[model samples]
Target chain A: MNKKRIAIDMDDVMTDAIGRFIELYQQEFQEDLSDLRLPGRNLTNTVPPERLEAIKQYPHQPNFFKDLEPIAGSLEVVEQLHQRYEIFITTAALEFEHSFTPKYNWLKKHLPFITWKNIVFCGDKSIIRADYLLDDLDRNLKTFTGTGLLFTAPHNAHVTGYTRLNNWQEVAAYFLH
Target chain B: MNKKRIAIDMDDVMTDAIGRFIELYQQEFQEDLSDLRLPGRNLTNTVPPERLEAIKQYPHQPNFFKDLEPIAGSLEVVEQLHQRYEIFITTAALEFEHSFTPKYNWLKKHLPFITWKNIVFCGDKSIIRADYLLDDLDRNLKTFTGTGLLFTAPHNAHVTGYTRLNNWQEVAAYFLH
Candidate 1:
């Protein structure tokens, strides 16, 4: 049976979160945090450990969610895929306090087509079952048991192994074919 | 006076070396190294010292160069830029023995408009004095005193600092404007 469930990671996969965060951080702090490279996959390396922990403690930084820019072609791709598959927004950000509500609000505001019931915010996404997990993080792919499609991002595209895609159209082609 | 000389990196900026290497490595060794997570950028972990040394000593493998692909819009961009700038194909692949010859040959074969005389192979690129250096490697960008335009690749696109471009069209637009 072709499992039609599709799970997507939020940060770089759906929304340009890391890019927006770095832009905001630099504007506010006058500090360039773009070169802070983190090991592993995804936006996990955008901020230092201390800062990440601090953000987690107080997740409601004004305009943090508002600042998010959707990845190019994401809304269109999601809309197309949703027709054939059960789409779920499975993000690691769900683990942090006040994570889901703000993200949900952001999505609702930007993409009203995505239903609230379809979103699944959780810290650990590997535990959730799905046919395909489109993620920018390598660690998350390692944890996921399903077919993992690594979204090509500036950070994770160089990573070797796993299926790599330049954009969501490619992802749709891969699964739909 | 702005130096009219333009020095371009060979790897991703000129020829698709990494793409070819990954393709061959997979075809020959059945080793799929598609992950963008190269050692220095991600993980505190290092590739085994022996493996690293082996790669260093491996007589710059030119097998991939035999079928190198030109990055999108590279020829058009170079042609347009050449009208206003003295274009130099500067690369650090000379350390790999005669590997650069094939790369040169491939460029000439594919991009016949680019003259071989304009190409300069050096052991280190940053030391080359030029008005501008278009490179994809961040390390090399740091070493150059000239204005640098980084070619965005799947892996290094996440780099925070420096001017980035997705394709040669973007590069041409930047320099021409």
Candidate 2:
């Protein structure tokens, strides 16, 4: 049987971006983001307008994506998934052009098991062709024609329709079965 | 109705890679390649053993892809197609990791009309899902599930199966009809 091509998101799916971004927000302003993850709407409303502009630039900052720690159990679970599925890291990196090299490097360093050839640095998720897309953003999953598996992230706490894989363990459970 | 997504190759289709590679071959080996473009052959057979090693390094060389001239009439023709169809540039750049920045920069410089969001830097062609694919390599076009249009390059002179597009003008005529 042909292996299912699985397109996995990089930011919140593979890395603890929310956890790190909150840490950064705290360091930059000394104010804890207590309710940004709470279900509502509009990501910009999560922070003050002044800090929102600065926070938007965080993904482009040098070493931001490079130094990020992996989402817990993602390494092992993804490696296992890689063996059975044709896994591709389909990431939206156009907004953060500077994040391209660092994100690529981070993937190379951390997820060494996945083929470098399978990594896709794309601007739009709508162009991705896969059997299943595991992402954290509702914007990405919303228009996807294939199976959309929302890998739970703080930003998408209240999304509907797509099956939610709460974590890497959930991902393994969903696919492995 | 949803517009058909058209996938186009980067090297010989957009930029004059065939001419540039030939020029590089002469400068590096001081000899003309007689018949490397002939049917049923390997690309390495075009040069001597030593130069084959050098040729392998050509794609990774600085400014190799960045300095290439756009194919005659490609910019206008692609722009026309882009308006009617969802055009995505599916390029194989993983083999030449260093070529990523230059290739992306070259696209941005020359094909400013094409959205940055539509550009796809990928290693394999089989991953692309589109209604039509315009590529120069027989290897890539051969495996594509879509309607592959062979964008003529010297290397694929004798391959068969896909419809042949000798130039961008021919590409325009094919889709415009």
Candidate 3:
């Protein structure tokens, strides 16, 4: 039997991109973002209007995604999942052009088990073909033909309807257990 | 009604990568390759064995894919196809990691009509989802779930089984007409 294939999103699902954004915001404006979580929205509201452009340029910077820490339990759970399933690191890397090399390097450094052959850097997630897609964006999941597993992020706390995996441990429980 | 999607390959189907290889070979060794068409095989057979390493490095060069001219009539035919079909430029770009930026820039420069959202930089074509895939490699087509249209490239001249599109005009005839 063919092993089930899973297309995994990178940004917030695999790595803490928002956490990095929060870190950048704190370093730039010296503001504590303790109460920044807003349901059904991203941290954009927390960012000052005057500094919005600077926040936008963060992803465009070289090595922006290089040193990002993977989401809690993601590295271990995803590595275990790789043993049983054909997992692809399907990231919408085209949105930030400079993220291509850095993201590829980050994967190589952190998730060494994933071969370059299984890494896809694309724009739209709709063209992906897999048994399941684990993404933070409902927009991506809505267009997918396969089963969509909503990977919870602060921005999508209010979003519902799909099977939600709140964390990498939940992902492991849903798939492995 | 949802429009049928067609995933198109880049290297040989849309641009003449092998032709560029031939030009580079002639310039490097100063040998006229006028009779180099080996029919079933690629121009690699024509290159001296000692120079094979150099030939392999061509794709790794920073601007290798930047200035590659599109195949005759490809620009026109693909642009026309975009009007009716949800077209995506799906390329195995990870094989040459340096090719990401150049390939993306190349598409942006020549195929401005095709948005960045429609472009995909991937390694394996098997992960692609669409109604049809137009590619030169039989391996890619074999693994694809969609109908495969074998775009005639010199290396794949002997390859048969899928519907063959010898040129852009043939592609237009197959799809548009």
> Which numbered prediction scores highest in DockQ against the true structure?
3
Clashes of 2: 0
- Candidate 3, A43: how far from true, in Å? 2.8
lDDT of 1 at A102: 59
Between prediction 2 and prediction 3, the one with superior DockQ is 3
Q: Write candidate 1's Cα lDDT for B17-123 as tens digits.
A: 66664565456557665553352332112223444454333335646456577787887888888888877776654345345447556756766665644555444
Write down the DockQ of candidate 1.
0.01
lDDT of 3 by residue, B1-177 (tens): 988999999998888787777777788778766445456765567667887788879888777787888899999999999899999999998888888888888898889988878888888889999999999999999999989999987778888799998899999999998
Each candidate's fnat, in order?
0.00, 0.60, 0.82
Q: Which lDDT tens digits does candidate 3 get at residues A5-71?
A: 9999999898888777777778877987645545555657666678778788988877678789888
Candidate DockQ values, in order, are 0.01, 0.62, 0.83
For model 3, the superposed segments whose C-alpha errors exceed 4 Å read A34-41, B34-38
Output the lDDT of residue B38, model 3.
Answer: 55
Q: What is the C-alpha lDDT of each candidate?
A: 0.66, 0.80, 0.87
- Quality of candidate 1's docking, in CAPRI categories? incorrect
Highest TM-score model number: 3
Candidate 2: residue pairs that collide: none
lDDT of residue B8 for candidate 2: 90
Better of 1 and 3 by TM-score: 3
- What is the Å distance of residue A158 in model 1 from its true position? 56
